[model samples]
Target: MTDLKRVDIYDTTLRDGAQSEDVQFSVEDKLRICRKLDALGVDYIEGGWPGANPKDDAFFARARKELNLSHSRLSAFGSTRRAAARVEEDVVVRGLLSAEVGVITIFGKSWDLHVTQALGISLAQNLELIHDTIRYLKKRVDRVFYDAEHFFDGFAANPDYARQTLEAARDAGADALILCDTNGGSLPSQVGAAVAGLRDLNAVLGIHTHNDSELAVANALAAVEAGCAHVQGTLNGLGERCGNANLISVLPNLILKMGRETSVGEERLPKLSALSRFVNELANRPTQKNQPFVGSSAFAHKGGIHVSAVLKDSRTYEHIRPEQVGNKQRVLVSDQSGRSNLLYKFSELGIELDPKDPRIQTLLEEVKSLELHGYQFDGAEGSLELRARRALGQVPTYFERRGFRVIDERRIREDEDDDRFMGAEGTVKILIGGVMEHIVAEGAGPVDALHNALTLVLSRHYPSLGEIELADYKVRILMGSGSMSGGADAIVRVLIEWNDGERRWGTVGVSDHIIAASYDAMVEALEYKLFLDKVRPV
Candidate 1:
C-alpha cells in the first residue's frame, strides 16, 4: 500500500459541539479550550456563530485579540444568505467578516427538502446561495469552505441536483467543499461512493459526519479512503443529536490504521483523554465511560480468559496500547474475575501477592464478598488501593469520624421583634491520631450544616486544607417513586479545586446518601491532593 496522505483536521468542538442541549461554555472556558486545541495542532478551529449570539460574537472578538494560536487557523461559521438578499449585503456575511478570522465557513442546502421546506426557496436560488456566498467570502479570505448540508441524503434523492450544488460552490471559488451528514444517517459504503463521485471536482473535498447512527468515525474513514482530503469534527464527538465525528477516535485510527499523518502534535495525542474529561467537567456533563478510544472502560478487561491472555501479552486481546491514547488499561475484579485478574490488580497497586500464597485466596474471597455489597472496584481505584493498604497494615488515616448529628427547628417572635427560626444545626466529632475534636455549625439545610461542621472540624487540624474548595456539586436521585414510601436514594458527585500555586486534578466519590456521598468525595479529594503534594513536592 502507498503511504497515507496527510489530511487537515478542522475542529468544530467550540462551535457545533456547543449546540448539544444544555452545553454552554463561558468566554473564559472557550479561551481555555481553544488554547488546548491550538496546542493539539488541529489544522483549523471553528469558533462559533458570530452573528447568532452575543456570547459567540464576544468570544470570537476576544479570541482574535488575545489568543496566539500556533498551528490552527480560527474559522468563523454562519449560513449563506437570506433567500432574497444579495451576498454582499447579507447579514450573515457581514457577521463573518466582523469575526476577523482568516477562514469563513458557510453552509448551504444540498438537500432539496431543506431548500424547498426549510428555506422556502427554489432549487436554483439555493444554488445561487451557495455560489454567491462562496464568491463573496473568497475575495475576503484565502480559505472559504462550503458545507453541503445533508449531502449524502440529497445525493441519494437527486444525484444530479446534489452534484450541481457542489459544482456551484466549486465554480464560486470554494477552497474546500465539505459533505455534511447533517441528519447523520449515512452508511459508510454510501459515504465512500458519494465522495468518490465528487472526486473529479476542482475543490478539495472533506467529510463532516454525525454520530446518530453511531458510525460517524467509520463513515469518515470510508470517505478518507475514497478521496476526501479533510475531516471536520469535534473533539470527543461533541455536537447536536448524537454528535459530530469523534476526532479522538479518528486521529488515532487515521495514524495507526490508515497510516495518515495528523496535524495533532505527537505529545498532545497522549493528552486526549485528559482533555476530553476537562471539557466534559467544564460543561457539567457526565462523561461517557464507554466512549471509544478515550473512555475509562475503552481499554478495561474483566473476563478470565481475556485477562489471562492480556497478561501474557496485551496484543492477545488489545488492539492498541493504552498509553498511545493517554488511557490506562484497567483490570476489573468482578464475579467473573479469575486468579490472573487478581494477580494483575495486585501488581497494578504495587502489592505483592503470590498466587500460591493461601493469603491470596483469602484476599480474593474478601474482595468478592465486598463486591456483593455494591462496592465496585472497577471505578474506584484509589479507594480499593486504600483498602488493600489497610489489609496489609500499611495505611494510616490522619483523623477518624467519631460522631455526627443534624437538628431542625423553627421559632416565631412578637410582631415588634419580627419572627425568627432555627432551621438546622449540625455537629461532628473527629479523632485525629487519638486527639478528639468536636464542632457545631448552622445552615439553611441539613446537608449544608453537616458539610460545614465537618469542614470546620477538619480545618482546625489541617490548616492547609482551607486552600481546597468545591468547584462543582451534583446530586442524582436513583429509582425514586412518586410516593414517599419509596425513600429516594441519592448520589452526590463533587469536584474539588486545590491550588498550591500550581495545578489541580478532580477526583470522584459515590454513595447512596447525598450527604455521605458529598462528604466521601470531599474527603477523597483532599486526601488525593495531599498525597500528590507529598510525593511530587513543589
Candidate 2:
C-alpha cells in the first residue's frame, strides 16, 4: 500500500444491478441492500436514479427518512438533466436536488456518435450539458460525480473530443468523473490508455465497466493501476447485458492483489462472501457456486492429490485462506476423487477411517460405480454420509416406504371450454415405526404432488419437516435423451435443492419417469435431514 493509492468504492447494485433481465427490487429491498452495502464498507452507494422510475423515487424517499448509513454515502443518479433543458427547469434535475442525499451522480454522453445521433444534439452542445448539469448540481449537493458514459469507446473514436468532455466536467467543479465502458466491449489495454489520457484532469477519476467482453474486472483494475481514484460496480456484477464489474471481486483485487487501499478494510473482507449471497438471495437468483472468491465451490477441493496437499498445506492448492473471506474450505468426494479425498471428507463429517483399510478402497470403488450410474456425491453430502453409514454397517431406517403413485390429469374446464388445466394427485403408503400410514395429496404438478404427500407423511415423525423447504429444482435431460412422449421411458436427471432454514444441500435422482426421479431426489433429501439430526449430531 505504500506505493498504491486508496481507491473509492462506489456501489450501484440498487440502480445498475436492477437493470439486469428479470431483476426487480422493491423500495424495502433497495433500503436493505443499501444498509448491507454500507455495512460492507463501501464508500458511495448509487441508491437509484431519483426521477427515472417509481421504485427509485420511493427508495430515495424512504432512505431520506429511514436510512442512517454510517460509512457509505447514498448517491442519487440520473442523466445530465436532458438535452438542451435548463438545469433549474428540468424535472429530472429538480428531482435529483430534492432527494436530500449528500451526493448526486449523472451520466453524460462522451461519445461524439451518441451526442450527435442518440441525443440528436451537436457535439459542442453535449459538452455544455455535461458542464452545466454538474455545475448546477454542485451548488446544491455536497459532491457531484460525472459519469462519462462510453468514455473508452468515445476516446477510441475521437480522443480529442473525449478529453474535452472530461475537461468540461473538471472545470464544472464536479468532485469525480467516472469513465464508463457502457457497451462493455473495451479491453484492459484500452481502459489503461483511456485512463492515462485523462491523467491531467483535475477531477477525481473513477472506473465503471460492464462484463459483456468478460473483462469488466480486468479493465477496472487496469484503470486503477493507471491511476483512477474510484471504481463503480454492482454486487455479483449484476446489471444490464452481461453485468457491471463485481465489487465483491474488485475490492479484494484492489486491496490484496494490486496492493491498493479501499474503504473495505481487511476486517470486513470476511463479510464479502455473505454479502454476495445476500444480494443474490434478495434478487431471487441462485448464487453461482463457481464464482471466483465468494462462491460455494471457490475453495472446494475434490481430487485426491489436491485434497491431500490441501490438508498438509492449504496454500498448495488455495491461493488465500477461505476464512479470510468467511468461506470455508470443502473437501468433496467424486468418481475422480482418490482415497485422500474420501478420508478428508469422512474426517470432516466425524467419521474415522483408516486410509490403508481395505474398506476404504471398497468405498471408493463403490462411489465410482454409483457415480457412473447417476449419483453425484459432491453436491449431496448428506447422501454421501448415508452411504458411509451403510459401509460402516450402521442402519437407521426409521421408516419404510411401501409404495407410491402419481397420476397427472389434463382436462378442459366446463365453464371455460377453451381453457385447459393440468392437475396431479399423489398417494404414498409407508410403514413408520411398524405402523402402516397412507397419505394422499394434490398439487399443481406431479413433482409437487409427490413432495406434498411425502412431506405430509414425514412431518408426523419429524416435525422439522415443516421447516424444510425446496429452495430450487432443476431438471437436465441426459444426452438429449429424455423423451417427452407418454410412456417414452427416457432417462432424465433431476436435481432437488433442500434447505432447513439454516443449511442447504443438493440431491440427485435419475429415472425414466419425472415423478419417480423427483421422488428419489425428495426421499434422499429427507433421509439426509434424518441422518444429520439422528445419527451424526447425536
Candidate 3:
C-alpha cells in the first residue's frame, strides 16, 4: 500500500455549529470546546466571527487569556472588505486583526449570482474584494485562508469567473483556497470535478460543505480523493439548516477508509466518541444514535444470526472494530433474539449457562412472551440480568414486599386566579427477617412518594441503599388509549435509570396503570442495586 497522504482537520463546531437552531453557546462554552478540539489534534479551530455578536466578541477576548491550545491554531472567520470599502478601513477586517490570532479566514463571493443580486457589486469589483481583503490581511497575519463561498455553484454557472475568484485570492497570498458548497446541493461528482479543475492553480485547496442534501461528507471525501488536503466540518454535524459535514464521520472515512493521514491521527482517534458526546452535551442536544462511527447503534447487533457470526468473528458483520472510534459492540435482546443473543447477554452479565441447558430455551421463551406483553430488554439491561439470574436461582430475596398505598389529592381554590394545590403521599410495608417495617412519606408526585416511602423502610435494613439515586425516568405508552384498549385501559411502560455514584443501570416495568408501572420499575431498580452489591437479608 502507498504511504497515507496527509490531510488537515479544521473544526467549526464553535462557530458553524452554534448557528444550529436551539444551540446557543456562551463564551465559556466556546472556550471549553476550543480546548477539547485542540486536545483532539485538530489543525484549525474557527473561533466564530468576531464583531458579529457580543458572544463571539467575548469569546475571543477571553480565549486570548484562558485558551492555551497546544496543537490547533485558532482562526477568526469573517467576510472580505465590503464591496467598495478599503481593506485598511473595513471594520470586519479590523475585527479579524484584533482577534490577535496568527491565522485568519475570510469568505468572499464566488457565485456571480450572489455578487450581482446579494452584494449588488460588479463581477470585477467582487474579485477585487477577494484579492484586497486577503492581501491586506496577509501582510498582517502569519497565515490567511480565503473561503471561496459558493465556489462549486459559481463554477457551474460561469467557470471562468469562478476561476478568477480563486486566482484573486491565490495571487493575494491566501495560504489555502477553500471551496465552499454554500447551498450544499452540489453532488460528489460535481465537487470532485470542480476541485480537479482547480488543480492548475498554484494554491493549496480545501473543502467546506454543508449537509442540506445529506451529501456533505460524500462531497468532502470526493474532493479529498481529487487532491484537496484540508477538510472543514462541525462535530456531530451541528449547524444551520440541515447542518455541516460531520467531522466525526469525515475523519475516520478519510483515514481508515481512504488511507489518508490527519492531524487527528489514529492514536487520538479513540477520543472521537467522547468528543462527540461532549459537544452534544454542551449544545443541549441529544446524541444521534444512528450517527456513523460514533453513535450508540453504530456497531450494535440485533439479529441472532448477525450476533452469532459476530461472536465468532466481528468482521462477519461489523465494517470496523467499534473500538477504533471509541465505541463498543452491543448485542441487543428482544423477540428476534436467538440462543446466541441470550448467550452473549448472559456472558455480559457474568452468567454462564450451557448451550444444552433446557433452562436456556425456557428463558428464551419467557423473554419473548414478556416482550409480546411490552417488555423491551434492549434498553433495560438491568431488568434483563435480574430475570436471567432468577431463572438460574442465583439471586436471593433480600426483603418481602407486603404492600404499598399511594394517595394523590388536589384542592381547588375558591378564587379562580388562586393556584390549586396538588400533593401525593405513600405508605410502604415490608417484612425483613420476621420484622415488619412500615413507612410513610410525602412527595411532589406518586412515584417520588413511593420511592421516598420504600427507601425509608429499606435504609434501616440496608444502608447501601442510601448511595443509590435516581438519574432519569421515562414513560412510554405501549398500547395507547386510541388503540383497541380505549381511554381507560392504556398499557404504559416505565423505565427508571439509577446511579450509585460508581455505576448506572436501567430497569423497566409495564402495566395498565402508570403509577403501578413506575412502582414496579422502581422496585426493580432497588433490587438490581442490592444484587449488584451482593447484599443479603438483614
Measured by TM-score, the strongest candidate is: 1
lDDT of 1 by residue, 9-92 (tens): 999999999888888777766776787788788999999998899999989988877788888899999998887788788898
Candidate number of the best lDDT: 3
lDDT of 3: 0.85
lDDT of 2 by residue, 341-423 (tens): 56765875689987788888888889877755555554455677777877887647867779999888987655777647887
Q: Flag regions of model 2 displaced more than 4 Å.
A: 1-4, 334-538
TM-score for all predictions?
A: 0.68, 0.65, 0.65
Best-first order by lDDT = 3, 2, 1
lDDT of each: 0.76, 0.82, 0.85
lDDT of 3 by residue, 1-538 (tens): 1122788888988888899998887665677678779988999999999988888888899889777789999999999999767889999999989899999999999999999999998999998999999989999989998888999999999999999999999999998899999889999999998888888786789999999999999999999998798889999999989999999999889888988988888877777876786676566566788889888788888888998998889999989987788776778773232576567658756898999899999999899778777776644668999999889988898888888899998755456655577769999888988898888998878988999898888978888998888766667776664554556578787877677877667788988888888888888888889999999867
Q: List candidate 3 segments past 4 Å from native.
A: 1-4, 334-538
Q: What TM-score does candidate 1 get on C-alpha atoms?
A: 0.68
